[model samples]
Target: MAASPTDTAPPEQGGTPGAAAGFPSLEEMQHWTWVIGRMQQMMMEQGLAALPEVPGVNDAATIERLHDFWSDSLTLWQRFLTPGGAAEPGAPPADKRFRAEAWREPAFDLVRQSYQTIADHLLRGIDALDGVEPAQKEKIRFATRALVEAMSPANFPWTNPEVIERTIETRGENLMKGLQHMLADIARGQLTHTDGGAFQVGRDLATTPGQVVKRTPLYELIQYAPVTDTVADTPLVIFPPWINRFYILDLTPEKSFIRWATQQGLTVFMVSWRSADASMKDVSWDDYVRAQIDAIETVRDLLGVKAVHTIGYCVAGTTLAATLALLAARGEADRVASATFFTAQVDFAEAGELKHFVDDEQLAMIAALSPEGFLDGRYMAATFNLLRGRDLIWNYVTNNYLLGKDYAPFDLLHWNGDITNLPAKWHLSYLTDLYRDNLLVKPGAISVDGTPIDLSRVATPSYVQAGREDHIAPAESVWKVTQHFAGPVRFVLAGSGHIAGVVNPPAAGKYQYWTNDAPAESLADFVAGATETKGSWWPDWQAWLAQRGGGQVPATGARVPGEGALPALEPAPGRYVTQR
Candidate 1:
C-alpha cells in the first residue's frame, strides 16, 4: 500500500483537532494569556499608586470595623465552601452594582473586592489627572467600566459559580439551551429576548383605526378617523422617529397617544416612516426633510388647513426642527402654526451617553461595514443594547444563556427588537453635520432643498419636553433649544428616561413633570424656578394645543385630500408599518 494514507498525512498546523481547530491557535492563546497577565500586573501597580495612605489604620475603631468585616466575610466564605449550602458576601459599596450570582463563591468574593478596589483607585487616578479633555475623560471612564464588566468572573462559564450550579441542577440542559440560543442569535445577527409573535403589527399593536391617505417612497401619510362629533380645525401631524415603528405612539387602546389626541376632538395625522433598504441607501438628509414637507403638505391639503400643529418625538423632533428651518428658508414658515418636541434636542453639545459612540473612527467603521450603503436594523439593535450592557446584554445572557429560560413575551421589548434600517447617506449626514459638527445651531452650516437651515429663525410657538433622566438627549440639551429658537417656548421636564417619559399617560399615573415659563438663561436656572406638577404632561400639552387649535368643526368619517390627490391608499397602520 506504499505508506498508508493516514500515516503519511501531516498533522494539523492550526491548534487542537476536532471543533477546537476553529478556535484560536495554541500560540495565539498563549500570547493573549501573557498580554492579560501583563495588563493585570500594570493595573495592580496603578491601583497601588493611586491609593492614599490609610488614615489612622492602627486606630482601635478602624481595627474593630475591619475585624468585624473580615469575620463576617470569612464565615460566609466557609459556608460557601460547603457543598449544598448557599452563603455569599454581598457586593462592596459601588455605584455600578454587580448582579451576578457567582459572587456567592468565596473566591469570587475576593475577585469582586479586588476588582472594586482597582476600579475605585483607577477612577480616582483619572480624577487626579490635570489636563485631559472632558470628552477624553468620559471615554476613559467608559472604557474602564467596560473592561471591568468584561473581566467579571461571571462572564466565563467555567469560572462562574452560578453557571456551575445551574449546569449541575439541570444536568447540562441549560448549557445545551444556551448554546442553541447563542447559535440562533448568531444566525439572526441580533440578540432577541422576546417572542417574535408577541404582537402582530395591525391586529395586536398599531390597532387604531385610520386611513393611509397617501404613500411616498419614504413614508405613508395616515389620516385618522375622527373619534368625536367635532374636531380641531388645525390638524395635528406627528413625525415619529424612523429608527423604530410608528406603532409606539399608537401602541394599544389605553396607551396610544394618537388615540388620545384623536379622542380630544383633534384631527390626527401621522407620518409612518418606511424602513430603509439598499434602494434607499443614497437617501440624504435633504430627502428626509423633503418627505416630511410633502407629508405636511398632504395632510394640510386633506384637512383644508393652511397651517398645522406639528409634533416630533426624539430624533423625529430633530427632523421637524430641521424641516421647520427648511420651510422658513423657503418663505413657508407659516406652514406650521406651532411645534412640539418630545425629548428632542436641536443642539447636540450635551447629548448624553449616545455621543460616546459617534466619534470619527466609529463612524468610519460603520460606513465601511455598510457595503450596501445601508445599516441593517439587526446591527443597530445590537449596538443600542451595548449602550446599556448590564440591563440589555448581560441580563439576557444570564436568563436565556445560563438559566436556559425562554424569553418572556413583552410588547415593549418586542417593539424595541423590531428595528428599522438606516440609509447610509442619511445616517452619516446625521452623525456628521448634526451630531459631530453641531450644525443646526450654527447659523448657516446646513442647507436643504436649496435653502440654508437655521433653527434660531424658527419662531413658531414651541412646546419642548425633555426627560429628566434621559440618557439619549439630556434634558439640559433639549432645553437649549429654548435659548436658540425665538418663540414662546414652554419647557416641560418629565421624570423618566427617553421613551417612558414621553409615553407616560395619565392612566399610568407613574411620573410627574415640572413646568416654569419664566425665561431663564440656562436649563439649571429654569429648573431652579420650576414647580413640580402631579400627573402626566399629556393633559398640559393638550391644553397648550387647545389654545392654538383653529376653531372646531364637525368630525367627518370620510377621508379628505388636498388639491391634486387620489382617494385613501389603504387603512391606517398601513403597508409600510406591516413590512418586516
Candidate 2:
C-alpha cells in the first residue's frame, strides 16, 4: 500500500479516498503544482548551472544532517498515531509550522507530520547541495519557505480545526465575517487586523501633549510641550522611521519615550513623516534627510540653541546619520551636538532575516507591486510580519478569523497594524545602497544631498544600542557602527526585541542591559566583556545625554506655540499619523 498525498490513505487497487482523510483536493493539487512550477522558474533564473553536487561523500556534518532528517521522519510516524501536536522541543526558534489545532486531529496529524518530514528533508537537501552557492541557496531557501507556509494545514480553511469549530459554532457567520474582512482589505488596499476604534490617536495612543510646529511636504516637526520647569540647553530631536508612525515612541503616557524624556528635563522635538502616497512618488532619500535638516534648523532657531542632540530609531537612524554626514561635509556640523541610534544599522552586512528579501528577484517583485510610485504599507507590513509569522501573522489569523473575535485594545498591536506607505524611489534606493550595495560603510560609495555620505566623518559623540533578541537588526550588526564614528561610541545591548528595547522606561524596571565603553577587536569581544546591570537602558541613556549637555535653562525659553517661521501646523499625534 502507498500513502495518499496527505498521508491518510493506503493506496488500493481502485478506490477513491474521502476528503475527510486529509487528502489534497484537485484544486489544491493544481494550485500547489503551479506554485512549484513558479519556484522552478525562479530557481532557473537564480542560476542552477548544474545539479547540486552533494556535500561530503560521508563527512560527519553530512552524516549528522542525514541522521537528524531520518529521525524526524520516524518521529512523524509516531506523531500521526498519537498526534502529539506540539512543535518539536528542539525545533529552530523560527519554525512555527505545527501550531494549528487541526494538527491534533488524527487525520490532519498525519498531514502535518508528512509535510514537516518533507520540509526537513528538503532543507537538508539544500544544505547538502555542494555547488549551489549562497545566492542560489537564498532563493532556494525562500522558495522552500513559501511552499511550506502555503501548504500548512492552518492555511486551508477546511483543514483548520479552529476555523471549522467556529463555523459550527456560528453556523457560518465566521465565514461571512472572514469574507467581509478580506473584501474590506481589498477595498482599502491594505491589510488591517484591529478595529481602528481600538485606539484613538491623541486620545488613547499618541496622548502626549505637543504641537506640530513645522510642516514639510515630506514631514512635520513636532515640539512637545515641556514637562519640567527647567530644560536642557540642547534640545533632543528624534528622527523616527518614516515607514511607520512616530507614535510608537509615544504610545500612551505610561510607555511614552517622549513623555519620559520631557519629564526628565529634556526638551523634545520629533519628526512626524507624512504618509507618502502616489503623489509623492518622486520623493527621494535626500528629500527626507533635507527635511530633517530643515526641522533641526527650525527647532534650533526657535529654542535659540546652537545645536540639538539627535535620536534616530531604526531606519530613521540611518537617515539621521546620513543627514549629519551631509551637515559635516557642508561645514555646518555644529547643527547636531551628539547622536543616538536605537536598533538602527549604518552597516548592513550582518542585517538579519530582512536581508533575505533584498535579492534581485525579490526587489523586482517589490518594484512590480509599487508601480504607482509608492510601495503599499500593507505589503511592507505583510513582508515584515513574515519574518516572525507565528507571532505576527498566524496568531492573529486564529484570533480574528478562526475564533471570530475582535482584536483587543492592545496599543502595541494597534500600532503594529497601522501600516504606512513608502515612496518607491526612496525604498528602492535604500535596498540598493544600504542592503544590497552596503555603500554607507564603504565611505564615498554613495552621495547624499551632494555630499559623499561617510559615517567615518560623523564625529559627534554617539550612543549605539541594539535589542538582544532583535531579528531585524541583530545586536552584533548594530555593534559594527562603533567602528564607523570618529567620536566616542558607547554600545549597549538591551534585553528585548527592537521596539521594546527603546520603549523600556526606567520606571518599568523590566529588562537588563549590558554596556561596555571600551573598544574591542570585534563585536564578540565587546559582548563578552560587557557588564550586565538589571534595569532599563533608558536611565543609562539619560545619564549619558545629561553629561553631553552644555547647561540647563528655565523652560520658559522653550519654543511656545506659534513661535517662529515654523508655526504650529496642527496638534501632536497629527494628521499624517491618522492618514490610514
Candidate 3:
C-alpha cells in the first residue's frame, strides 16, 4: 500500500534485506524456525553513519565504571537464579518498553534489567571522559544512544515477551503480517507514522475559512475572514516554518490557532510556502528575507494599513528576525509594528543535539545526497528522528514491523509525515553561516540582500517565547534573543516541546507558561524568577498585542481577500499546501 512519508528513518532504498546479508546460510537451510528473527532483520538495515568513537576503558575512572557495570550484571544474575520473591531487579523508571505483563517472567525481566544497567553505565562512562569538549561529548552520546536503542531486546521477536506471546496466540500469523508490512515499507522507502488516508488538507485539516490573496514562486499569502464584528485596527500576519505545510497552525477547527485568532477580534493572514524544487537551488537567504518583507508589505497593502503585527514560528521566526534586521538597516523599522517569535533562536551558541550534525563531513554527505541542490525533506526528517530515536524510530519499528499493528490515526503525525524539500543554497547557508559559524546574532556578520543586518538597530517591540523542553531550539538559545533585541522584550517559557508549545491554543488550556517581571540575561536565572501561570499562553500574547496599540475598530468595515488591494487567487488553505 502507498503511504505518506514520516519523520523517521527512511527505508533502505536499494540494499538487500539485512537478513539476506547477515544470514547467507538461511536460503540453504530450513527457515521456518528463524521466521521471527527474519522479520526483524530490516530494522538493522540503516546503521548510524559517521559516529565518533567514544573513549574506551583506559583510565581509572572508566575502569571503575566498567567494574560497576559488571557488578550490577552479577547482582541481576544472582537475583534471577535465587529463590522465590527474591525481588526481580527493576527496569528504569517510566520505561514503557518492558511494561507488558508477559515480561514479568524472570528471564525477560532479567533481560530488561540488564539492558538498563549497561545503558546507564555507558552514559556515565562518557561523563567520566576528562579531555573531550562538551560538544564532542554530546555527539558521542547521541551516536551511542542510537546504537543502544537499536540493541533493545524489545525490537526483536525472539527475546521480546510481548511479541513472543502474540506470535503464539496468532499461531505465527502475526509474523506473516509483519513481514508484509516490512516489505511494503521497504518498497515505499519511508516509514508510515500515522494512517495517511485518515486526513486530507482541505477536507479535515487546514479547514479554517480563508482565501489565498497572493501567490508567488516562493509563497502564497492567505487572508482569513474575521469572525467578530470588531477587529484590531492592525491585521496579524503569521509566517509558519516551511519545513511542513501551514496547516500545523490551522489543523482541525478546534485546534486551529488561525481560526481562534480570527474570533478574538483580529484579522489573520498566513504565508503558505512552496516546497523547494530544482529551480530554487539558488534561492538563498536574501530571497527568504525578501519573501518575508514581501508578505508583510502585501498584507499591509491589502488592509490599507501603515503597519501590521507579525509572527514567525520556528524557522520562519528566525527569518522574520533577519527581515526585521533588514528593515531596521533600511530605516523602515515601522513596517512591522510588533514582532512575536515562537520557539525561535537568534543565537545558536547553546543549540541542542542538532548542532552536532552541522560539522563539515556530514554537510558534504548531505550535499552529495541531493545532486539537484533540492534536499529531500525526508533526510531532514530522518535527522530529527535521530534526536528522539526510541519514540519516533524504534517504537514504530516494533509496532508496525514486529507486532503487525496498524499505525494510529493522528492529525499531527499526518502533518509530520508530509515531506517538503529545501533549497541547497539556503540550507547550506543555514548550516554553515547560522549554526556552524554562529553568525546570525552577530551585528553585520551576515548580509541579506547585500545589506549588513544589525539586530541592535531592530528597536521594534518584541515578544519572545520558548519551550522549556524544546530540543530543536533549546530554550536557552531562544532566551538569548531577549538580550539581542534593542526593543522592550517580554520572554515567556511554555511547558512543552517545540511543536506542542507553539501550537497550543487558549481554549485547549493544556499547558502552562512562566513569566518573570524581574529581568535576567541567563535563562536559568530568568526561569528561577518566573512565576508559573495556568493555561495556554495565547491569551497572554493577545493581551500583549493589545498593549502595543493594536487598537480595534468595528469589523463591518473590515475588508476580505479579493475585496481590497489584492485579488484572491483561490480559496485557502491554498494550492501550495495540498500539492504534496
Candidate 4:
C-alpha cells in the first residue's frame, strides 16, 4: 500500500486505491442535504410574495413569522412520518384536540374546508407524478407537500374569534356609512326634481342667449354651423356607439372633444342614436347600417360634398367598418373619404371575459329577458358592474356603505349610471355573429344587407384608437382592425380603460397616446416600435382634424329643417336619464 497509493482507496469513493482519501465526509453530505431542503422550503414560502396586502392590516410581518413557524412544525411532523423516524407504524396518534377546538367555529370550519380541498388536489397531483423524472419528481413532491402544509386551517389568522369579531364590526360600520350615503343621494334627487320645475317656471325671467340656429334632423349636428363661405371638399360624419349617450365627445365646456374640434374649425356631426322603443324591437344590424347610410347620403346631398370622413366609436366602429367594406365591394368606395374607429372591436377572438357571458346559453337567457324586443337598461348596467365587481361594486360598498361618508356628488358617476336599452334582435345578432363566431375579421364571415363585410375592400384612410387597460374592447382585439383595413392605417394606443380613454379631457393629469403610421405585425410589435408621450389625445386629434378640415369657413346660418314640423321632444339630456 505504501508503494502504490491507488491500492489504499476506500470502496465507497469508487476508487480501487488511495484516491478515496479525498471523498466527502458523511457529515458534510448530510449537511448539504439539510441546506438544500431548507432552501426549497424557503423558496416555496416566497413564491406568493406578489399577492396584495390585506386591507386595513398592520401585522404582515407577524403573519409571515407565524407562517414560517407552522411550516417548520409541519416539516418536523413529515420527517417523523418518514422511514428513518423513531415512531412506529401503530404508534399513539399525536394530540389533535387543539386543532379540533380551533376549527369548531363556522369561520374556522370554512377555512378547514378550503384547506382540505387544496390538500386533496395536491395529493392527486402527487399521485400523477409517477411518470416524471427523478429530479423533477423530488421538486414537485417538495412543492406540493409544502403548499399543502402551508394551507392548513390552523395557519389562518381569522381562526381566532377576536379577529373575526373585529372584521365583522368593521364591516358593519362601513355598511352604516353606505346607507347614509344612499339616503343623501335620494335626498339630492328629490331636491333636483323640485329645483328643475322651478327653473322651468323661471326660464322666461332670464334673457335668452343667442344660440346657434342650425337646423339638421340630427340633434347632435344641431350645434355644428354648416360652412357657408367655403365648405371642405370632403364631408365629415360620426357614427357613435349606441351603448353610451352621444355626448361623450360633448361632455362639458372644458372636456368636450366635439367642442374642441368645432373650435379648431372642423365640420363635425355626431350620430345621436335613437333610444329604442317597443316598435324598434325587431330592428337588426342591417337596419342600423341602412339608417346610418341614409343619414350619410342626406348629409352628402345637403352639403354637396363628394365624399365623407366617417368616424365611429365602440360598436359603431364595427358597423362603420362593415358599411365601408360593403361599399367598397359594390364599387362605391368614393362615398367614404376616411374612417376612424375609437375603442372598437372588429376582431372578437381576444374580446376577454365579456365573451364568456355572450355564449349560446347566456344568449338564450338574454333573449328570454328581452322578449318584448329590447334588453333593459338596468340589466345592461348590472352586467357591466359584474365585469368590475371589486372596483364598481365593492368600492362603493366600502366608501358609501361602510365608511359612513357622504356620497360624492360626481357628474361622471351620474352620467355613467344613466343606462341605455339595447334592441333585442340587434343585440342578439351582435353577440352571436360578431362575438361568438368572430365573423367580422374573417373574409365573408358576416353579411350586412346581403353584402359580405370584406375588410380587403376598405381603402379609406383609417385611424384606430384603443385603450391599454380596456376590459370591454381589449387593445389587442381592437388592433386587429389594422389587418382588416387596406388603407393608410394609423393605430393609436391610449391610456386608461374603455370609457376613461375616450372621455379623457385636456387636463394636466391626463395620459396621452402612442401612434404609428408604419404597418404593425401585432399589437406587441407596435408597442415595441413606438415611444410614449403625456397629455390628453384631444390636442393630437385636433391637429389631425385640422390637417383634413381644410381652412376655416364662415359658419352657416340655417335652422333645423324639420324642427317645427316634427314633435318638439323635450330639451336635450331628456327624462330617461333621470329615471334611475
Candidate 5:
C-alpha cells in the first residue's frame, strides 16, 4: 500500500507533509535556496565540512532500492494513465496535505502521488552517496531535501488544484494580491509573516500591564504590576533573548506567560533588550552580562531584596548560565535565588542543525554585509527558517504568494516577525565562545566580565525545560544541562517545539509534559522513568518555584514598578521593543 503523507508527518527534508507545504514566495526564496547550496559547496571546499566515515556501498541493497523505485513508479504511471477511466490514485486517507475534495480527482491526485514518489526516490538516492564524507554527506542530504520541498507539486500554481480553482473563481484577483505581497516582501527584504495592522506591541499583544522601571543602553527593565493581592517574596525577573522582542512571553492576555505568572501571585520583571544599531555594533558579550547584572541589581534595589528568582529563555538562558558562572566566580552567586532555563543549552556538542550556518565563512559574509557592526535580526531569522524550511519558509510561499491569501492575524506570528538586531561583536562572541568551543559548560575554560568562567561554579538551584521536538536546541543537548549544574537540578520534558513549548500557558490547555525526580544516566534514561501528565507544565513549575519563593507578602503592600528605588521610565512593553 502507498503510504499516506500526513500534514503532521515529521519532516526530515523538503517540508512537513502538511496541509500547507509549497514552493517559494514567487521567485524570492528560490534565490535564497540557491545561495544556501552555493555557500555549503564553498564551505565544504574549505575543508570545514563535518564528514562521517565512508560506508562501503552495498551492491545488493542499492539494486533492491532501485528495483523498488522503478516498481512503484510503474504502478503510479499505470494507475494515472488509464484510458478514459475515472481512476483514483490510492485514497489519500491519512494525508491531510491533499485531502481536499478537489484533490480526490484524477489530475490533482496524480500530481500529489507523482511528487511524493519522486521526493522519496530522490531522498533515497542521497543514501547512495557513500563516497562523500559523513559531514558533507549530511549537508548534501539537507540541500537535496530542501530542493525536494521547494519543488513540491503543492507549491506550484499550475500543478496545485486549489490554486487553479481559486484563480478561476476570483477571475485573477488573487494573482494580483499575491503579486503585491511578493513586491512588498521584496522591498522589505524579508518575508511577511503576518498582517502588520493586526497586533500593535502594547495594544493587542504584550498586553500584560507593567512599567519600564529602568532604561539602559543595552536593555529596558520592565517590572510588571502584581495581578494578585499578594505575591511571592522573591521577585522573578525574565531575561528574554535579544534576537527578537521580549513580548513572546507577554503575547495576548490569554496566551501571555507574563500575565499568567503575575496571576499566579509571582512578581515578574522582564528584560527588554535594545535593538542593535550602528552605535551598538561594537558591544561584546561581557557588555551584555554587565547589563544583566545591572538589571539584577536594579531589581534587588527596587524591592529591597537580597536576591531574586530568574528565568532565561533561549539565548538569554545561555547568557544567564554564563552570568551565574560569573556571579559564582565573584562569590555573589547567592544573588540569584533560583535559575530556570527554558529550552536553553549550556553545551552545544549536540546543538542540532544550527551549526551548519554558524561557521567562520558565514560570519565573514555577514560582517561584510553589516560593516556597521550589527547582525540584522533577519539574518538570524532566515537561518532559523532554513532549519524548518518547509513549514516556516515554503508553506507561506504557497499560501501567500501562490494562493494570494491576505496575511493572517496571528499574535504569535506577529511576535515572530518582529526581528531585532544584535551587535556583530556580540554575535561573533556568542557563536564562537558558546557554540564553537562549547566552552560555557567546560570548567574554567572561558572568561566573562573579566572572570574565568566555569559552569561547575554555578550552584544556583536550577530548573530546566526543553521541548522533545525542539530542532533549535535538541533535547539531547538540553539534557546535558543536568550534568553541569552543581545545585539540585530538575529537568522537565514538554511536548512540541521551542517557542510553543516555552510560551505555553495553562489556560489554553494544549499539549502535555513529563517529569521524573529520580536520577538517570542520560536523557533517554530520564524519559524511561518519567511520568507523563496532560496539559501545560506551568503549574508544575509554579509549584516548584513556590517552594523557593521566600514565602508570601500582602497584596496591599506589593511594591509597584515606579514606587521603588528606581523611577518608571515609561509604560510596560516600552520603546526598545517597538524598534524594528
Candidate 6:
C-alpha cells in the first residue's frame, strides 16, 4: 500500500485494501444449491405420485389364489387359441405384450411394492379392529370379507366369443329386422336408389305445422293459430328452447301444452327461435335477450295489455331468468307479471352425467368444430344420444335396423330428429360459463350488457317443475334453483324425463310434486323437512296460476289480425326454422 494503491488492491475485491467484496460466500452458494435441489426433488415426487399405479404380484396366500385364478384364465385362453378348437385357426393374439426391456424390472419392483402395501394396510386394519368394540369389529370384518370376495377375479363372467356368435345367429332375423328398421328411418327422406324399392320418403308423416308470419333480420315470428279472440288481460307468451322447434309445446291436441294453455282461456304468443345461418354468426346471448324483450313489448303494445305472463321451457328458462335479472337491474319488472320454468337449469352443481359432455375437453372440441359460431345439428344429436345411449342410440340400432320394421310415425321423435343448430358464441359461453364453471349460481359470475345476472333479483313469482326420471335435467339439479330466486317459488318434481315431464297433459295419470306452504329458509332444509304428495303437479300448478292470475279477468273483446296483405308476407316456417 505504501508502494502503490493498485498493487495493494485485494484480489477478491478488485480494489484497494478497503474495498468491499461483491461475490457470494461459498457457504451461501451451497445453501442455495441445496434449496433448489430439495425443491426439484419435491416436484419429482409429486409428479410420480400423480401417476396411476400398476397392479402386480400378491402376498403368499393371495398369490396362490391369483395363480389358481390365472391358471383357469390361461386354460380358457389356450382353448380359444388352439387351432383345432371351435375358434378360427388364424386369429389375432388376445394378449397385450409389455416392452420386455423397459417394463420387466419396473414390473417386478411394482409387484414387490404392491405386496408390501397390502401387508401394511392389512396390519393397520387389524390393529384398528383391535381397538374397536366387538360388534363394530364383527361388522368391519364382514365388510372387509365382502370387499375381498367382490375383488376376486372369479366373480367376472367369462365371455365366450363362439357362444356369443351362436346366440346372435339364433336371433339373427329379429336383429336384422331391427337394424333394417333403424337404417330405413335414417335413410328415409335423405337417400334414394334407382329401384322403386329404395326411394326416399323423408318424414312424410311427421311434418311440422305453422308458417313464419314475419321475418326480421334476426328472427321470424311463426304464428300457428287462427287469430281468434285475443284475451288481452290474460295474454300468454311461450319461450321454447332454441335447441328445438316451437312444435314441442304444440306437439298434438292431446299432448300439447300450448293447446292446453290456450284452452284454459288464455291468448298464447309463442316464440319460435329462428335457425341461424352464416348471416347470424356474430349473434350473442345479449341479442337473444333483446329479441325476447322486444317480443314481450310487441305483444303488449299490439294487444294493448299492461303486462303478460311468460312460460319458459328447458334452456329457455335460463334465458328468461337472464331477461328478468336484466329487467330488475334496469327497474323494468313491470313488463312481466309472472314466470314459469319447465325443468330449467338455474343451478348446475348437481347436473349429473350431462356434465361429462360439457367438460373442458369436449367444449374445446365443439369450439374447434364450430369456429363459424354455430354447433352442427348432427353433433348436437350425437351428444344427446350419448347421454342415453341405450335408449336413443342402441334401442334404435336394435329395433329399426336389426328388426327391419317400420318405425312408428311419432311427432315427438320427428321433433327430436329435427334438432336446431346453436349459435357458436352462445353455445360455448353456456358450456364454459354455466355448465362447467357454474357461474350462474356464483354471485356476479355472469353478466349481460355489463350488468351482472343477480338471480336473487328475479322477484317475479316462479313455478319451477322437475321430472322424477329426467336423465337430462335431474330433479335434484332443478331443485337447486329454489334458493337462487328471491320470489315466491313453487318447486314441483314431476313424473317423467325431460320431454314427457313438460309435455304432461292432465289425462297422463297420477303425478306428484313437493311445495312449501311457506317459503323455506334454504333449498336443502326445505327438502329435508318436506313431505311428498301423490297426484299430478298439473292441477296444483293450475290452482297456483289461477290464484296469481287474479281470478282471471273476463275475456277482452279484441280480435287477432288475419294472415294476408294486412300482415306482411313472410317466408314459410320463416328462414330461422331452416338455419341449422
- lDDT (Cα) of model 2: 0.76
**What TM-score does structure 4 among the candidates reach?**
0.65
TM-score of each: 0.82, 0.81, 0.89, 0.65, 0.87, 0.65
Candidate 5 Cα misplacement greater than 4 A, ranges? 1-65, 83-95, 556-558
How much lDDT does each candidate structure score?
A: 0.76, 0.76, 0.80, 0.60, 0.80, 0.60
Comparing 1 and 3 by TM-score, which wins? Answer: 3
Q: Model 4, 1-580: lDDT tens per residue?
A: 0112222212122222322344333333334434444444345445424223545535665455445444544444234223343233342223231243424432233334435545665565564544587544654665565556544434332332323332354544544555666676467432110112222211321111112222232223322533245445555677778776665665555665655555554565555666665767878888778767876776666556677788889999888888888888888888877788889988888886577677568898999999789887667776676566545654454344444445554444554565667889999989998888888878888888897778877888887889999978999999888887787777889999888888787764688788765666999999988877786776776566556654444445221222322332343333332232
Model 4, stretches more than 4 Å misplaced? Answer: 1-177, 180-235, 558-580
Instruction: Give the Cα-based TM-score of candidate 3 against the true structure.
Output: 0.89
Question: Which candidate model has the greater lDDT, 2 or 6?
Answer: 2
Note the clash tally of each candidate: 1, 0, 1, 13, 8, 23
lDDT of 3 at 538: 91
Compared with the true structure, model 2 gives a TM-score of 0.81
Q: Rate residue 158 of model 2 by lDDT.
A: 68
Q: Judged by lDDT against the true structure, how good is candidate 1?
A: 0.76
lDDT of 6 by residue, 1-580 (tens): 0112122211121222322254333333334433443343344344434333325543455544434433433333232223232233232332112112211222122222233334335444643443587544544554454454333221221111221222244444544554455465567432111123321122232122334545567666644443334333656777888887767776656766766665665666667787755566788888888888887886677656777888888888888988998899899987898898998888887776667667567778988988677777667777676565545654444334433335665667766777677788888888888887888887677888888878888899988888878877887888877888888888776767888877777776656556666556655566666677675576777777777664344443332333433263442334555455
For residue 315, give model 1's deviation from the true position in Å: 1.9
lDDT of 6: 0.60
